[model samples]
Target: MASIFTKIVKGEIPCYKIAEDDNYLAFLDVNPNAKGHTLCIPKQEINKIFDMEEDHYLGLMQFSRKIAKALEKTINCKRVGVAVVGLEVPHVHVHLIPLHDMDDMRFQRKVSLAQEEFEAIAKEISKNL
Candidate 1:
């Protein structure tokens, strides 16, 4: 079965896209931790980040770095925090969160945003790319 990220990448599901390349995709999290919170994933569906081949792994980070740099410039935060908690979905993904403080990255906290708000944030990040 295709993972949800794959569905988003393929346009089976709608996403607030931030950036993309031939090998990777970056989009905003609908249920975001912060205004510009985004998820970066490889076009290939690998179950674990470590399971990816060396070149793919390196490409993924390089791809993500581009998005992170844009996120830092666009979002109101000190830094963009990276996190990988693979259990939520079967596909490998990295979370790029705009961190104003330590609590901004907490996975246990509940965060919510309207679809329009997410779309606006996505547009802002995309413009910075």
Candidate 2:
């Protein structure tokens, strides 16, 4: 079965896209931690980050770095935090969160944002790219 992220990558589902390249895709999280929170994933569906081949792992990070740089420029935050908690979905993904404080990245906390707000943030981040 195709993972939800793969559906987004394949355009079976819509996404608030931030950026993309040949091997990776970056888009806003539908349920975001912060205003500019984004999800970065490989185009290829790998169950675990460590399971990816050496070249794919290296390329994914490099691709994510570009998105993170643009996200930092567009969002107001102390820093951008990266997290990988792959249990929620079967596919490998990295969460790029705009961190104003340590608590901004907490998984235990509930976070919510409207779709329109996510779209606006996605556009803002896209503009910086």
Please report, as a residue range, the 10-residue window in candidate 2 with the lowest summed lDDT.
107-116
Error of 2 at 66 (Å): 0.8
> Compared with the true structure, what per-residue lDDT tens digits does model 1 show for residues 1-129?
999999998999989998889999999887777778899999899999999999999999998999999998888889999999899999999999999888889975547888888888888888988
TM-score of each: 0.95, 0.95
Given candidate 1, what's the lDDT at residue 36? 86
Scored by lDDT, model 1 comes in at: 0.89
Question: For candidate 1, what is the TM-score?
Answer: 0.95
Task: Say what the RMSD of model 2 is.
Answer: 1.1
Best by lDDT: 2
**Runs of candidate 1 exceeding 4 Å displacement:** none
